[model samples]
Structure formats: structure tokens, C-alpha cells
Target: MVLSQNEFLPRAESTLARLEGAVLDALSHHGKPSVSSLAGVFRQEARLSPSQLAQALCPGPLSPIGFAALVMRELLAPVDVVLEGSVSEARVVTGNARAPSSLRVTCPLIVLGDLEVEGVLEDCGPDSTVVVLGRCTAWGLQTSGNFLVLGDLVVRDVIQGVYNDESLVVAGDLTTRFLDENDHDVTCYGEVHAEHHLENGRSGDAAVTLASTFLRPELWNVDLGELHHDALFERIQEGEPVFTDAPQAPQVREPDAPTAEELEGLDIEGIAAQASTNARAKDVVYAQRKTGEVWLMRPGSLPLHIFDGKQLLGQGTPPALDVKQRASERVTFWRKRGDLFLEIERFGAVVQLHAGQNNGSLRTFRFAFATPDDAAQEVRRLEARYTGDFLRVTSMIPGRGPLERELANYGGPKTEYTSAIVDGTTLVTRDGERQRFDDEASALSALEDWLAGKRQAGFDLKILEWKPYGLLG
Candidate 1:
């Protein structure tokens, strides 16, 4: 039942409307706001039950961001307590402000302007919230409650949320050195630039950048995905580099082999060492150094995997190949899809195997192999694994491989669903009818009433998944 800020906003407004005029007035105070104080107002004036008050406050499970938005919009906005210029250690602020070096807030704070902090910011006690309307600059932000930034967020060091349900929402760009979700929900509306980002357990994000990545930038060649969270954390804390130089082959030219003098100050040895350790090294036929650069090439390859002294750059079509060995090594495999048998095709080092049909749909799986016999053996393994019509769970190799997941829809259109906020109140019927409320408040009221009835009918509804419908528009 815990909804996002947008969904909960209308519902919160609707809940507040049921309160007595005296209770509403008492809750709307210009002084510092705390959840306990407002709850007392509801208990004393409106006589709302414990469950009722808790529902009004949070609606679902504990969410810091949702709770913060509820308090700000419902309890605090009516009063005028806006401060100007630089302020610190206050519950309400406008203009520039600085948080204490090591501050633990038990009350809700609203920052109307930019807030800068070179220390730790954490929230303790139930319903602690921090709302920054402008830019936020921090050395580290470790929050247990909700933290919402309407503008950009620049964390010089790290940003972490303690629990999975703890909410962190940044409306603009977020720049940080390291981000550990710690199983929390982090939503970034704009771009994210982080040197190291870790999504431990259920924690994740929908960021344009590689937000949920745990790989270290310094150890760019190593894939630490196989390591457990604890091991990864320990390694990172110990400052242990994960990469070692790949064993050199005689055919592979040394970046310093006479060509090192061509590009002075360039780390050719370093680049060559790193390139030899990349995930795509299996497909790399050879590495050739030109003036000012080095090329990692495959058979009939483009200038995709080019190294410019510092790092690998510009991955173009048929990636991980240079133009030298364009027609060197080729592997092929035959694929049968019902009555149609297709000839094998090799694009660079990738070998595509057409697996049998599933649910009357043509399906194919790709694997990289150095020889045709190796490719054929993989095809036989694929055939042996398919019973054609059996459903069961089995273990798979880990990492971001498709085989790791249940083979539900081998290669169909994929759509990812996440928590999203819509503009208006959302309504759906048991018969699949889509409805919307005229206003935000009305939408929330209706949905709450409907859910209450469903609960009474003996259904346990923990989370609600919402999908957009044409009629809703």
C-alpha cells in the first residue's frame, strides 16, 4: 500500500480532509514539525484510531520519502515559516544552508534553497525527512528516512540509504563518488555520474548511466559481479584492486615494443595490460599499435575497440575487433526451427545458434566459440536441455546472463515495470475498467475506500502494481 509521492499526495489530501477543522489547524503549525506531535493532534482532536493515524501518515510500509512528502504537503505548507539567506541546523530553511558535520535529525527539514554539507547527514527516529528544493552538495548522505532533492545533487564522497524501503529521490542530475543503495529505493529523474555504484540485494535504480553497477573504475578489467556482497564490500573497503594483467601472447604486440616512443607519455603498457584482461578478450584476435593508439581487432573487424593511452573508447558496430584479421578465423553452426533449417552465420567472433521454437515463436541464442566443433557441441547441449514442453526451476550460471533467469520468454519483447508517479488519481475495476479522478484528492479517497473493502473481503494486498491503459489517457 505504500505508494510513491505522486500517488500518496492525493490520498494524503483525502485523508486529511476527513479530519476535524480543529485537528487540521493544530497539525498545521509554523513551528518545527515532528511526526509524534502531529499524531498527537490527530489522536486528541480527531480521535483517529492507531491504524487510521498510521495509514494517514504513511499509507503503506515505512517510506522516508513518502512520509516526508505527506508531512510537508499536509501539515506544514499552510504556515509561512520560510527563512532567507544561509542558515544551519534549522527545521525550515530558504537560500543557502549548511548541515552540521555529524547531524542526526529526528524532525522533518525543508530546505528551500541550496544546501551544502561537508559531513555526514543521517535521520533517526520514525518519520524523519529531508526535503531540499534546490541543489544539495554533501560529502556523504546516509539516510534512514526519506531524502528528496528537487534539483541537482552533488555528493563529493558517497550517498547511501540504510534500508530497502528508505527513499531517495533526486529530480535533477546526481554526481557522486560512490553510491551504495544498501537495498533501498533510489530514483533519479535525470542523469547520474558516479565512479562506483553498488546495488546490494533488492536495491536498484532506473538511471541512464550505469547506476546499479558495483564494478570498481580503477579495476576496470575485472568483473566482480560473481563476488558476494560482503566480499565486494570488504575488497572495496580494503582498497584492493581486482584486476591483474592478462598473460601476454607472443603474437600480441607490446604497447612499448618500439611503438611506445611514438606516443610519448601514453600508458601503452597499461592499456595493453588492461585490454588483455577485458571480458571481450576471447573475441580479440590480436592487438596492433598504430601512431598515438592501439587497436584490438577480430576477423574482418571495424575500428571499434580502440585504445587512446588512457582507456578503451568508442565501441562501434561489431565491437571488440580491429580491421587487420577481417577474414582470419570463422566458425559456423546449423540451426533448425521446425521445418526451416538455417545456415550458420558468423559476425566477427560471435556465433549465433538458432534454438528450437518455443510457444510457436522462433528463438535463437548466441555464444562465442573459437571453433566450429565447439559451436556444434553447444548446439547439442541446447537441444538436449530442451524437453519442448516442460516447466521447472533449475540453477543457472550467475552474472547478467540470460541463462541465470528462468527461461520464460527466451527472446521476446521485454518491458520492465517499476514504481512510477502519474499526474492524476488512478483507478481500476475488477472487470478491467480504467478510471481516473477529476482531482488528486478525490482519486486517493476512492482508491483507499476500494482497498478497505477488498481487505474486508479477506484479501491480503501488500503491493499494488499499476500499468497504464489507453482509456486512462
Candidate 2:
């Protein structure tokens, strides 16, 4: 049931119209019409069947007008040959006692074997041995010895009388008009025109500027004879390698660097002796240098300990204006004229503990701590480890001269407004009521009228904690 080219062209034109007058009377008496006399007139007048008369005949041995023009072009272009290996879509006219080997045809092919053709191989006789693995358009591609086109041969004009020896590897483009010397060794890889004199044989590794500017330029045209266009353009800009051989140099080396026993077995430490007092040494507890405060040293100290690194705070001591005649007088003061004030106050408020200095003067003094209850338990452990806004005494009344308190941390809302402003115009609200704007569309129309509530009655409207201020010229 292999009939499908619209049912095998109307049953091969109704069995070639019932054996077309006995195949034109046996091609007028044997001019060539014997596949057992057309399979006995297609098994008795076209009832067909010896494999449908060998699928309507045309597998080799054809002559009666090339088998009636290949059965009228296979009943008008039916095409079906695709065979490989023991190929037999046959149409060879003679010459095959089996000498060549690899096959692979695909229609319109005559072969003994070594013929690859992937379609489009025409009239190749003269003991044909075609090899085209694809793309070859020939007319009288007569071969008596060799024709190994791996692709793109396209000869239509003057590629007269074929005769090949060994080297022939096309790989595309070899147009043809005058490549005589039995088509010189031929090693193409694209581009070869051949208008005239490529003298004789030998061109295996092709491409001496594509065999002298397109195949033959009369055998290397030095502008037709004397060599000088800047010495052939400096030998094709120094990349001279036309018929092959110049490719070697590529060996490079450079890698070595890790050695001190491969960087101590890869624990690696060598940026110029990475700190090694015989390794394993770490006693710094705390050390600071870029400006002030962290000095500490209890590991084996020489006295330093000014710690602001989580407070231990003062002891690099030395400036002693008779610090109460020293001898570790650790604290003792009641000076009304040389600062020390500590007042807390907030339970029933009486707050007044002033002490600012760093040159912003404000002072009052009254301190005593030669371990006054371990310095009031280290000032109640720095007011329970200070989490911002400080002051925390909440009841201490021992007063006869100095101790008196009741604070519990109080320092909120000291009224300083001006929330956001980093070149984003200005906004200030926390009830100080100040609006200075010329841009940011009048500070977003007074902040959308204080967020649509237009605030002001009993003014407690908060939400402003921004702080970067500068007023010093």
C-alpha cells in the first residue's frame, strides 16, 4: 500500500495506459525495454503486481528514451528515492560489478556505490563515482576517476573533462568556468571562481587569497605580472599562510605562588608575616586610639582605664589640683564655686540640678563619695543601665547637708520643634506655632492644615522630633 502521491499518480497513469502499446512495441524491438519485457507487460496487460511491476519500473537499466522519459517524469513529478547503504532507487545505466562502497542517494542518481548526493545530482555518467553530500548543481558532471564534492560545486560552464587524483574537499563554493589541470588538487572551503590559468595540479590547502583572488587569476595575478602593490599589501598584512602550514605557538606557563609548605597546608597566612608572636596571643580587653575614651586594661594593666566602652569611666587620672590632697581621695566635694551638682527631683518637683561645662558654664557642687555606699551603688548601677533620658533616684532624703531626691527619670517634651527638613522645605509643629515658608508649596499648605484637623485648642499636637539645627555664622 505504498501508493500515496495522491494514490500514486492515478495508479501510475492507469498503469501507463495499459502498457502503452506494449511499451511502444518493446521500444521498437529492443532499443532497450527489457526488465523481463516490462515485467511481462506489467503482469499481463497492467493488472500489475510483481511489486506493482517494480513500482512502475525505473530502478536502473533505462534506455528506451531513458525509459520513456523516466515514465513521463514519474507520472509528472512523483519523486521517491531516499535510499542509503544498499541503495537501489536505481537508475544507473551500466558500470556496477560492485567496486565503490558508501551510498546515500535521494533521487536522480546513478551509482555503483561511493555516491552520497542529498538530492540534485544529474546526468553523471562516464563511469560515475559522485560524492556530493549536498548542494551540487551540475549538468554533464562526467566522472571517470574522482568527484568528491562535500557541498557547493555548481559547475555549469567550462569545467571540462573531469579527471581527479587524490585531494578534493569542497565544503562549499567552487563556481567554475576554467579549472582545467584536471581541476587541480582542489581543497576549497568556500570561494573559487577559476576564470583561467591555475597552471597545473596541487592546491590542497586552498586560500592564497582564495587561490589568488578567486581561484585562478591567471595563477596569482601580480596585477598581471610583476609583484608590487606594496609587496602584495605586505604579504596580506603579515598573515601569510595560503596553501597551509603556519599555526603552531600556544604553550604558556605562569602559575606558581603558594609555597611556604603550600601556605602551611592551606591555613594560609602570609601578607608579610601576619602577626606571629609564636601565634595564639590575645590580651587586649579594650584599646582605643582615634581620639579619646576607650583606654581600659585589666588583663595586666599599667594603670589606664578611662572606659567609655560601656562605662567604668574614670581612672587615667592625673590632673590633680590638690584633689583633696590625693592618696585616692576618690571624691569629696561641697564647692559652691567649682561645680558638682547632681539634684534629681520630680516626685513633687523642685528640680534644679545644673552642671554643664565643656565651656558652656553652669555649676553647683555637693558630692561625697569615699565609697558612699559604694558610690550610691554605682549611682544605682548607672540608673539601671541608662536607656536614654536619665535621672532616677525616687526617694533618698538623708538630708543634713547633701542627700535628697525623688526622680525616677523625667526629661520629656522640653519643647523644640521642627520635624523634617533636609532641603525638603520646612515643617515645624509641636505647638510652638511657627510657619516660615516660601516654597514646598507653602509647606504643603501648612501640612494639609495640620493633617485635616487644623489643630490649636489647648495645643498638644505632637509628632515632631526632628533635630539638626544650625544658626552659627
Candidate 3:
């Protein structure tokens, strides 16, 4: 009757326990037991091959009790052992079977038909033949011969002959004198070194001339006839000239703004003064001659008063000067039929007042000023009044004069891209165009279409996350 792995496990355990006791008794009676003798007895009694038994009792120094424990562990270790020439039909082996304690096939473990071992195979003798019609793994395989793995083969240590079909993965270095015939494709995660040459299967001619070709082809691709050790050393010591296809030019970068000391030598203030004269101070419409104060006039009787640098200094009536005589004298004041006009030519300041209107009424007064030191001070005061901080001005309505230009030097509002979460359902594109969706299905469909379009255009799309929210009634 065929027994399942579950039923066979208990019998295997009981048999190993009995074998351990018998091996221990033999060791005690023989003083220093010979490995070959003990191995021979175990093979006869347990039906294990010499290679399998030898591997179980590894070459090392250990007490008789310790040795027995090691032997028992190796025997009871989880593995699918097909006794000598027992596998006549196809068999599939699975699960992780690792290293010295795992699998042990007695004779040449031949797979005549098809066989699949998913886990591992280790420590097979040189004479043993493992022929798998399907895929298999050899975690620590040690063998050489008519070995054919039809599917993917992951192996380490000596392997010869055709690896047949599918890919062959080498875990460690693949060291061989030559690859006589390798029909299947191979990808080694580690290095591949050959003492001789690597040849193609068809011509059997050398494919690689030197082993260093696997490392650096440019340095090692010299003709063998032209290569001389002494000459090569002399040339290297003399620093051989390297030739290139094109000479690379050094990159030029824009110089950083000059330091304060370097700027001090420049007439930056003079240039600014000239530029300011051409740019009018739109916000500064009125100035007090005595206090050097400025005001923002906005179609009102009492102007929004400001002091040096556009700072809010409060409001007041025009200076009490003799308007009629000053108008006649043309000394900054003019009067016509109860109306008043004043102009401070030094600061380019202008102000006008109409009679019979409330002092704060919007239609009662008109005021303006041109760009000058006093006028610039007034502009700064106005900026301070508008933005709270003297440095920032949101709109260009006030004219980007010297004050605004200074603010520009300090920079402006910073914008950065960040992943935005959608409380409901929404779709957003790379260009910032957004569409709102009432349901998740529609949003997902639109997102899929957008991803497909992006993929066709050679874009790699990554969906960060999708979170669903439910509404409670």
C-alpha cells in the first residue's frame, strides 16, 4: 500500500530512534569507531548508500553521543529520499530541503521519465546520475555527468554537459576549464571564470579569448602577439596618452551676485536714483513740507496719510499758509475762487482742495507726487500701510518703482508640488487640471484611462494609494 508523507513521517521517526541507539552501542564497544565501518553497518541495516551515510557522519571530531545525535538528526531531517532505482514513474518533490541534513538518494537517482523536485538536492556522488525531465533545484549539488535539467536549474558547485532547455541560474561562481557543450541559456548572479576558453556549441571555437574579457574588454582586448609584460609596464609608468572621440569643454555657470564690498565699488545707488526719477510713485500723492510726510490719495478729502517709507502717520489738514499771496508769488500755492492748489516742486508733490465739501469726502481733494527721495520715502510708508510688513507688496497697481524693485530682490510667494488628498472623489492631471466625481467608480475609470494614455506615451505610472470612505445615514 502507498503511504502518504504524513503516515511515513511517524515510521521514519521511530526507525531513526532505534538506529541511533544501535549506532551508539557500536561506538561504545569499538572505543574509537571507524567511520567506514559504522557507515557500512548503517547502510546495510537502514538501506542508505555509502555517499548518503558518509555525508550524514561528516568528517569531524565529536563525542560518541554527539556523533549519534548528529546521525539521527540527518536521518530524521525532512526530505524526499527515493531509494536506489525505485523511481520508475514520474514524481514531483516539493518543500524546502536544505543542505547536509536534507536529501540522500542511495544509487544513481535516475528519473527515466519526468521528475520535479522543488526544494533542494545536495551531496550526490560523482557516479550518481540525476536526470529530471522538468524543473529542479540543487542548492548544494556536488556531481558530474549525464545530468539533464529540462527547466530552470539553480545550482552551485561542479556541473557538466548540456543544461538542455530553459534558463540556468548559478548562485555562486561557475568555474570550469571549458564549456564543451552548453545549449541552454545561463545567467550567473555571481562571476563566471574559465581556466581555458568559452566555446560556442556549433563551431566549438573559442568565443572568449581571455578570462579578463568578462571584466574589462577595453583594457584586455589587445592582440596577444602585440602584448609584452615589460613594455606594457614601461608604457603605464610613462602615463600613456588617452585618446577620445571628442574633447569635452568645461561647463560655464552664471556668476553669483557680487558681494557687498564689490557692490560698494559700483554706482548701484546712482543707477537706482536715475531709474527712480523715470518711475513715478503712483501711491504717493501728497507730502508735508515740514515733516517730510507722504499720503496715499484715493479720491478723498483727507488723504490716507503716511510718513517716510509709506508708514501710516495719521491724517491732518494742509499746512496753514497764505494761499492767495503764495499763488501770486508762484511759490508752491495757488487759489482760485475759494479753491486751493499747492505744488512742492522739490519733491514733485501736488495737492488740491475744493470748497463746500466735507474734509474727508472723496470728491473734495486731489493729490499726486513724482519719484524723489521724499516721494520714495512716502512710497515706502504707503507699502507698509497696505501690506503691514514694509517688504511685501501683493499687487503691481502701485507701480513697481524703486521700493517694489527692492521687494522683488527679496523674492515672492513660493509654490511647491505636493500630493493632495481627495475628501470625496476627484481626478487631477499632471498639468493641474482637476475634475470632481460624485462616485468612486467614475473617478477610478477616468484614472484608468489617463494611466493607459500615459503608458502609451512611455510613462511609468504609480498609483500611490486608494482609500475608500463610507457615509452613514
Candidate 4:
């Protein structure tokens, strides 16, 4: 009996082992053993074969036979697979927890009601790992509750539910029907490029500057032209007002004009009368004989000018207008009608006249002279012969128009090479240096005193030649 019992113990132990496994399987409705959960159930209920030593242990079935394999195989087959987990195929990862199959994976499919993360991630740098979205068999990767991925994320077509956890970043390209009816909702924090269609009622937006517009790197393999400035502005934005510099109008008159008194030698003077009630005591106004262009005098103002009815013409300051005269000379003043007026010398002795009607006068005089050292000797002798006993005085009435004031002052102290009106002649210096002045009268006095000293120094004096200024009466 004892020998029989020993032999039967091996067979009974085998049968009981099978029975306990069957019970665990039956509790699961004979579903496949899962690496995820079935192992725990088997460990708790599993026992050693009858009469086997307590130290001896039994290894359970290797892995869960997925529904397909279980249905296909008549008997249960263990399918334990060793695997390495990672974000990408590029690197190795740590974590004992794993999926049953990476390739032919199986898990629950949750169709998305809206686009959102599955609440499983954190913010990270530009190129870090996010989430790996893919198509798996029914019920494959079902976390009991929520999942968060600290890296980036990706979404594939078969992911049916809203992935509400991680923000997405794509090293390559991305596409989706996130807004299409009956399609899943996918919320992403990144930009969308490449060709794609979105689902119904979905909206997408991005923050970008006008300058952010740029060309795509490659259309497959062809190169694109560099974006033009105008097109670049147009591409990324609209409704921003386009702006450029405005065009300016051209001025009517040149800033420079030749003077009649300068050219025609018309230095005659008379007290002018006002023709316009608008004229004041010192208003200066001149009219051209042919064109009737009236040049008005506004002293100390810019744009010294003559005005026609339609346009004002600039007459830049004329050379000093003041010249000395004992008798009548050309004069400027207000007319009775309030208009400013000007006229050449009236009722004067007519010492001489140049052929041209506009040329006020042609005057010449002769003088005796003996040699003197150099520069200005002949001019000094000539001037003494013409007006040795008489003074030629010109006074400029102050607070007058700029046209006459700027152009008319004369006889300033000049530098060594400059010209000075000594006596009545423009004594030009040899080297053409500029001159300075203490006062106009002082400058004139110095030159005059120097000439007198020259004569007293026993330098020979005699008849000298003289001529009137271009402007004369």
C-alpha cells in the first residue's frame, strides 16, 4: 500500500497543479493570463506539487497569450517576452514596467470626444521626448486612471480618444483630422506644417510677427526662392496698413537773382512815394521795367524776394547798396497808394550818360600822378583828383528790409588780401586775405589816414585817372 501511494503521489501532484491553474483561469473567465495582472493572481493561489519539498519552487506560465493566440491555440501557451522600453529607437530607457507587445500591441481604444491631452506630461526643452501615440490592439496601454509624459508627444491615426496629458513636439511633420466630425480631438502646443485636413468645429491659431514669414526649406527636393520684402510682409499678416514716405512739392523760384542796379549802373536816388495804403514808412519794393515783377523788401527775414502775381521769386541779398551822394540819387519809399516804390535820380545835372537807357550814367575823370611804391598808388591818386576836397557820404536808414541792408553796407576793415573801399575806389588786396573791422567808420578812417601819410612821406603825387561806379547818376 505504501509503495502504491508513493507512485500515485507523483500523478496526483501533477493533476492538482493543473487544477489550481484551471481555477485561476476559470475565475478570469478563462481569459488569457496577462503579464500586467494575471501573474499576481497566479502567485497568490499557486502551490507546490503534493509532497514536494517546501524549498522547491514552480515556475508559472511564461506570459499572457493574447486573445488571438489563445483563440488560435487549443491549449494555453505561455508567451513571456523580454523587452527594452524607450521613447525612440535611438536610445535605451529605464523602467521595469512594460507593454505586452511593442509590434502587435493590444489595448482598449477610446475614441476622442474632443481634442485634449490625456493628462500625462510635463514641459521640457526643444528636442526632448514627449508622448508616443500609436495604433494598438484593443485595450493595450490602459492606465487605471491618468498618464502624464514629461517630455513631448506624438499622435498617430488609430489613437481614438482625447490625449489630454502631454504637449506635443514633432521632430519631423504632423497631421490630423482633429476637427472632422466623428474624428478625435487633438490639442497640441506646437505649430502645424505640411499638408493636412482638420476635423469639424476645430480651431487653431498661432502668434507670429510680420517679419516671421519665411520660405519653406524644401518642397520635397526643390529649392524655393528667397522671399521678397513685399511678399514677406504680405504672407504672415493682413489688414496692417502699408506705409512709405510721401512725395514733396517743388519750389517755384530759384534763391538767386541778378540786380538791375548792379548791371545797369543806375545809382540815382529820389524820395520814393507809396502807391498802396498797405505800405508803411520803411517798406521796400521794386518792380522790373519789363516783367512788372515787384520785389518787396522785408529787412532781416529769410527768402528775400520779388513777387509776380502768381509766384514769389527769391532774390538773394545784393552787394552793399549804400553809396555816398551830395546831390540827388536813386531813392526807395512808400507811395501814396500805400504801395512801396523806387526811382533813379530825378532832376540832376546829367554830368554824363551811357548809351543804354537803363544805364543811369557814364562818368570819367582825369588826375595827375607820380609813381608810388605799389598796390593802390594809382587808385589813391585818381580818387584824390576826383574828390580831394569834398566828402561823399552814404547813410543807411536803420530797420529797413533785408534785401537792401544785406546787399548795401560797404567799407569794412578787411584782411590783407581782401578789397576795401578806400576813398571811393575798391582797393583789392594782392593776396586775397579776409579783413576784420572795429567799426565801419574806423575802417574807412584807417585806410584814409594811411594814404595821407604816404603823400606826406615825400612820395611824388600828380594827375591820376578816375571812373564812376557801375551804379552812378
For lDDT, the strongest prediction is 1
- Return the clash pairs for model 1, or none: 2-60, 64-146, 65-146, 164-183, 297-322, 299-326, 300-325, 300-326
lDDT on C-alpha atoms for all candidate structures: 0.43, 0.32, 0.32, 0.24
Can you list the residue pairs that collide in candidate 2?
60-90, 60-91
What are the runs in model 2 whose C-alpha is more than 4 Å off? 1-67, 74-153, 156-473
Clashes of 1: 8
Q: Estimate each model's TM-score.
A: 0.30, 0.19, 0.18, 0.13
**Per-residue C-alpha lDDT of model 2 across residues 56-174, encoded as one tens digit per residue:** 44333333222333343343323334343433343432221221222333333432222323222222332323333345553213232234443467654334333444233354577
CA-only RMSD, every prediction: 22.6, 32.4, 27.7, 34.8
Cα deviation in Å at residue 207, candidate 1? 19
Off by over 4 Å in 1: 1-90, 125-127, 200-473
Model with the higher TM-score, candidate 1 or 4: 1
Q: Write the per-residue lDDT of candidate 4 for residues 396-416, one digit (tens) a residue.
A: 211111111101112335311
What is the per-residue lDDT of model 3 for residues 1-473, given as tens digits with 9 covering 90 to 100?
12233333344445445543333332333144333434333533445432343333332222222233333333443334433323322222221222232244433332322233322243233333343422344423323222333233443222333334323333234554333233534444346564433332532212223323331233222222111222322332344421123433322221222234323333333323332343223433433333333333434333333333323322345443222221110111222111112222121343333212112222223334553455445544433443321123111111111100000011225422222222236665434547788875565455545534443443331112222221111
Cα lDDT, model 2, residue 230: 29
TM-score of 4: 0.13
Error of 4 at 460 (Å): 99
Candidate 3 segments exceeding 4 Å error: 1-97, 100-107, 110-126, 138-144, 156-211, 215-473
Q: Which has the higher lDDT value, candidate number 2 or candidate number 4?
A: 2
Error of 1 at 388 (Å): 50
